[model samples]
Target: MHKINVHLLGHMSQCETQESSHDSKSKDFRQSDSYSVNETNHTKAPISSTGGTNNKTVPQTSEQETEKRIIRRSPWIDTSSSESNSIHHVVPIKTSDTCPKENTEESIIADLPLPDLPPEPPTELSDSFKELPPINYGQSNSSLGGIGDCNAYNAINSKKRSLEDNETEIKVSRDTWNTKNMRSLEPPRSKKRIHLIAAVKAVKSIKPIRTTLRYDEAITYNKDIKEKEKYIEAYHKEVNQLLKMKTWDTDKYYDRKEIDPKRVINSMFIFNRKRDGTHKARFVARGDIQHPDTYDSGMQSNTVHHYALMTSLSLALDNNYYITQLDISSAYLYADIKEELYIRPPPHLGMNDKLIRLKKSLYGLKQSGANWYETIKSYLIKQCGMEEVRGWSCVFKNSQVTICLFVDDMVLFSKNLNSNKRIIDKLKMQYDTKIINLGESDEEIQYDILGLEIKYQRGKYMKLGMENSLTEKIPKLNVPLNPKGRKLSAPGQPGLYIDQQELELEEDDYKMKVHEMQKLIGLASYVGYKFRFDLLYYINTLAQHILFPSKQVLDMTYELIQFIWNTRDKQLIWHKSKPVKPTNKLVVISDASYGNQPYYKSQIGNIYLLNGKVIGGKSTKASLTCTSTTEAEIHAISESVPLLNNLSYLIQELDKKPITKGLLTDSKSTISIIISNNEEKFRNRFFGTKAMRLRDEVSGNHLHVCYIETKKNIADVMTKPLPIKTFKLLTNKWIH
Candidate 1:
């Protein structure tokens, strides 16, 4: 006879039943065993004999009895008590007598919550039972209360069906259930629960979305992150640069106990993308902290490299020199800070909590730019044998090269190529420069300076235009005015009401609205100056009402901006040619609209031309009122002579020789008074005095005034509003 041995864990309790050999008045042997355990628990099934009585009895075929059983474990009972944690005895499942049961009770344990077991049997299991199948009673969902008709039972019943199909049926024990097949046995109501399987599959099959974040503060669901190392590298680079310049010291402990938190300047990273798709990281010192004078008392940054005198430089060195541009990097970081300043160490730099004592000037400090300018200017004068031009401190000249800087961007002009190289090398030795137009010939160099494109075209014309990148962001218009090709209609009102300042929105909305209006007008004004001269009068007329802008003013501004966008592709030609009339002089045109504004003030329009090319112009409201067109024109001339007289000085400045300039206007009376010292003709007291200064500027300087036909006066475009045909006729030749 063969005896089968079984092992059970201490945490388990079992009541086993076995059949006696005689059924033959077959008797059942029953034993109840209980044990307590602290660790994981296990259980084993009733063993049958291999002798004649070892016959694998079929459960349903037996007339004696068939009992179906199941085990229910309560997972949420008090774990602190061993009695509560112990496994309860198996409970017989109540089913109809007609229901079939398994001869072996293996299916009963299929849904029990069993602890995990190792692949290799433990020491508690004897080698005698090595080939036996593992008694794995895995945990199933408790949602199926007592596992009456759930998927676990359905799977078990399916196994029984497969076994019953064979002639000599052998029960197959499977520990797992196929959810899809298990759900097939369910009624329609249970169908909704099966959607969980499909939902899981759907989720796993689909991929996550990738998003580009602004500053990492607003992303909801993103699968990718930007390269974090780039930001870290930028921060480290800045910190190292500052350290090398002795901008701070953390080696010795400073007294931070008495330091006021408000006195410490906060610093942050300003990330920028350049035109070439590279990154720029600047550490800015927040001077807005502390007082208005803090970090702002030293030097004035408003004295940035002079740009107004550029035309003089252009006229002096147009044909004689190679136009080159370069930018000095870290220009502000080179100078020393006058006052002892403390800054909170930027977190990205990975510095400790200790405050940083700044020794050198840093970016974002109000006076840093001015300090750097002084340092560079001193270096140029002392080391490079360069003379500083008092008119424009940014302009520096050596024996052969002339350099003009606006902030950090330096434009160099040298007649000799070797002289340029020498000057550039000298600058490079003293400062790090990004050579934008390095040894390139002026004819091939199209450099952008101060939003203006200074380019030599085809080795013939020195063209000054606008930077395309600067204006591309403005709103584009399909039509100059209304989209339907109709002229813009006014908003029922003229100007803003005087007391309208009292009307306000929420603080943020008001600021945003104002900024929107300002940005629209500001950029539109620039775009007009670049190529859209038609927008000049409108923008000028609209800008006056920006402070208390009404809906009407905004409506007009939008119309003008739309017009500018419509003609965005146009540009006035800036070229120098021997005058068609043999006059190596300027052509000045001044016009005015008398008492045209809502305040009854006159508008002055002035245009300056050199060698027949429009160099500069203005369309502005006159500071004082004018009674007549003559007075307005005369005042406009007075306002304009300062700028034109400066041009005369520029001409004489070029070669130390007298150069003549011409002024053209339709106001013959105003022109007559300006060219003469005749006080009798000056009707207005204000304009009379202005005319005397105008006469002195015309004669004292070599500027000449002449009268041109109104149709021929291009400056008429600046004076007042005109029809499209008249505007085109007057401005088409000079602009666009």
Candidate 2:
């Protein structure tokens, strides 16, 4: 039998009683081999079963036999051999770091399903190898005195290379397990040692918290360290702003009872530069957003040129009026959060294991802006005696002044300086105010906003004047290609760029490319909508290809860019265009080309004129398909009536009475059919429903339906592609 030092702490009495009975016989034993003496008198596994017993003991009862376990060896390190076991180590499984430290051996072992043991195990032992006792895998290294100090752990895991062949487990002689040499288990230094099963390395040794960066990013004017300093400064600045806003009460939520980890939202500081050449750091909360089930509402940017024309008209109407733009600082924070929400403290802010409950709306949150707008809307409509413009809640006015809310941007109009003071003071009490720009031009018109310049060619007549620096971005194109022939997902045309190698298209990368193309298409569309109305048709056709643009489609986009560059000199001409008649009102020319799209739908064209100049126009698809030119034109007319009525209402809101306007159309047949007294012509139910809506607008809004020659119609340029001569004549005579 081998000499085994048993660090027995909790179960000493059972082993001592069994060994005292076997001590009378003499036995031979080795010195170095370690083994376990069973504390319970159950299925006892001898260290070397071939060794003979000095005395033949009586068999134990079935209950003790059934309860017998523990393979007479330490579960953490190999002890059956003089050297380390080259085979598997009998150790408990490792667990996640987040596992609680207070778990017991039984608690930990209960989770592991009993693994299937192989049956061919009698080569080394005869029915003696015992079952393993449960070992807690969560034990700390400090609690277990150097379990990894074993030779197996110290070695380079090179047991295979060191041996010429695989080591086999060998049976020993009968004298190896002489029963007289077996001693009783001794009491350990502490009771805790026996319960401590498997000791893994400490949590600190597993993962380290990284404080410094591994690499630095390059910047133009600042070094990596300097940029980091700026970022830290910006981070602190944002923290201060949040503190000032009373966004969260940290002291209240610091209690663990009040804040649950599952309920806590996450927040972080975001850094960016502004369009006005300034740095800004904003803190945002990542609250789990529930789907909005309330009434739909939105914020809108008041058109700059439209506002400019209105401001000029205001000046023309009353020279004493003043125009200015104002903004609210941290507008989103003014509204309180209506739901129960909590935000975790930002990492690296040193907030000690705490989360913050959100009290106010936060920037970059999904629905914060909408809530803030609602909050402000309530204040303006209820408290300020202001009425929203027809079809536009963003533009609010009373008898004193007009207030336009473009998110944070506000353009205020007043009759005098005192009125402007009252308006500013009233808004200042409700919000943190910043005056972006304020002035009134008595002589030469000075129009400047949105980094865009405006050229006043004549009285109240203006054009968008882009800066030389801005135009420098667009290279001059003498010969631009037309984009009429390309299709979006057309199959297998030879591309300038190959896709097999050097240009493999990953799905994600392809989607990103398509998104970039879509953004460019949007930029082109906006420019067309605001200034270059001539390019509207071209942009709409290209926009249809945004989802699955092929190489040819991309080529078409490049051609459109070049074409825009070629006609960059063309500008949006905004001026007062109402005729000098007894009843001053608008004249809208509307038309439609049926089946102009691939979807068998019509393209709508609308042109509204006021004070003998172009005020508003659109080249877009009709909302519904129309089988006839008359239905198409009528749909086109239905779309324009709302816009014309809105314009007339704006003028009327300015204390000017706008009477009935003329809606001119080139389709005389369509005009004659609508004016007919026969209601039977419109009784197709669905068609009749749409026709009745049109009929109601024609009579209800007091609009005159007139017809003109197709050649003379100003809206004809938008319906289809025209010859260069006719397009030039139209541009020179009317559109320009």
Candidate 3:
């Protein structure tokens, strides 16, 4: 008979090594007890020797010995048993000790808690449990929600799977967390419910939950919120009423009160009809009339597009400088028609069926835009000695300087300080020029016109801050930067009536409209500072006409004027006791938009200064007809490139720092075509040559082309009447 005794920690247990020992124990304990304990120990020794070494060297540290015993006993221990036979392997730190300790079956059995037992007669026991397999780490527990099905016994003994596989399984499980819960990860559609839940959850999650707000804070929040609501309510009401009152009679045709046939023929190259009664009938200019510069019997087209280019160029060049835009109140009234054409009398003013004779140019005349361009170009070039750019017909020249005219607006760029001042002063004398003098030169005004707002500081203008209060008034205009309003005036004002009143209107209707107009101007006036209106003056044939007099327009103008007035009062403060280094670079943006007619187009002209002066810029339509917007813009840019080259040369000649020039356009396709040297064929003979030439210029000039959003394109305003908001935004780029 044989017995095995083991001590693990403190508890002791005993198992019979031989069947004879188990049989004897099973018989009478009294008979087994008769056997000597020394005899049982001696009998067990032979069985232990048959298995492994009995000279077990126990570790001095109980923890270390326990781990060693578990590792050694792992194979023999039944992993399926209630007690887990797991071992945590620890890498031993490298050291220079060379003593190796022996591990034996007896040592494992001794380490296990076991009581001494008497040996009995031989009895056979099944050894099937010794063949149990080790388990992988992942298979260890179904209670832990493992992917593969695993029994408790196998799971307890399993070794862990590799890290990569473990992570994959974890990801799958986490991905399905929301689906398993049948609830969305995002908030539900009902925001109110979600908010309620969020509030409740927030309270629960707060480190130190606060169930109520302080009494004073609650009262203050309520009062403040109420006041804010009241202000918003008042603002909405006033704005809505004014907007509702703004109506125009688009169906009715309006006629001018006076008609001079000779002026009409000379300006429009069209005839007029006589009235049945007296000559009191108003004359309306025929927009489709032919002119020497615009329409011809052979070509049959007008050169208004040329004026658009000139306007854009001028505005772009004078962004930061004073831009005194002037309108010849009754521009055609000054030019008598040379030809004699006939037309029907005005529907409203005419008596019996009498036709009107020759007359002055009116608002709707087709050749009116061209005539205005011709008049201004002649004055600037012929009188001022300003030479026009050859390839681009939009440019004109003054002595040692150049003046670009876009109908009512003009931009002046000079070669030297003397020339620049001389040109500015001369133009001021010719037109009703209101020199803002916001900055050092005319280029500053062009920059501001390109959507930069200018603020005067110490005899110079700085770009106004975008966040100024004037920006708040932008959205009121019903038009984009290109004034696209069908109704120029509300129902009360009748006919194609142009208000040329120099005296301020006191009535609410007129005042309200003016206020609105001023809002746009105000917004445009802001650039790097608040807007000022003190310097704002009306430029019209009529001593009274402020072009933008509608409440919406006036509001915009007032704000802008105020911005200017306030800005002029300010002085620049340089805390650093050294002269600041100035950037010597030039930026120009050019773009174009097609008109209501497919053949007609508008152009955007822009230019920027690095060291605060006009470097280069031109916004103009293509001389030849373009098949697409891309082609037209490319032509404009091509024309601008040469101007820039000349400008750079001029700057160098002026003994100024070398300027790094840049060309910007809003058309991605045009930029791509120019950069990649892809030229589009134009069906129109006039535009085809220029289109190809433009592509060549863009490639040859090494022009730095960039794409800009329309909102930021300073040329936009030059091409069209901008809505108050867009106008205001664009105004900041050039006017400070």
lDDT of 3 by residue, 1-736 (tens): 1111221111111111111111111111111112222212322221210111111111122464344323312112111221121111111111221212232111112111112233444322113213324323332111101011122222232223334632332232312322444433453332111111121122211022122233233332536675445433433442343223321122332243344333333211112111211111122444444344433234221222332332233223333223333322234333333344434433233332344453433444554455555665676667666755654444554435444444444444443545656666666675545543323533334233322333323223333333332233343333232122122210010001221112233344334433433333333323221222111111100112233243322332333333333343232211111112332344455655332111233233444333333222333333454334455566667667766666545434322433344566655445444444322324345555665666555445544555543434555443333223333444443343
Task: Compute each candidate's TM-score over C-alphas.
Answer: 0.62, 0.58, 0.30
Ranked candidates, highest TM-score first: 1, 2, 3
The digit string of per-residue lDDT tens for model 2 on 1-736 reads 1122232122211122122111101010111112222212224433321111112222343565545521221112111221121111111112222323243222222211112222222222223222323233322221000110112111321121122211111111112212323433554322111111111001011122111221122122346576666666766777787788898766675655675455455665556544443456677765344233321235332333454344334333332456676778888889887766667676666665666777887875555777887888788787777787776557677887777676777766676646666777778888889877664554444445443354442334555544441254443211222324322111111111111111223444445545655555755665666555555665665565554344544555555665555455555555533333333445677767654443345677887665444555688767686654556777888889887887777656754543445676655445544565455655357766777788777777766665443434556556544333334444553334
In model 1, the worst 10-residue window by lDDT is 23-32
Prediction-by-prediction clash tally: 1, 8, 161
Which regions of candidate 1 are displaced past 4 Å? 1-233, 250-257, 260-263, 289-298, 302-313, 316-320, 349-353, 470-472, 475-511, 528-534, 579-584, 654-657, 675-678
Best by TM-score: 1
lDDT (0 to 1) per candidate? 0.48, 0.48, 0.34
Cα-lDDT of candidate 3 = 0.34
Return the TM-score for candidate 1, rounded to 2 decimals. Answer: 0.62
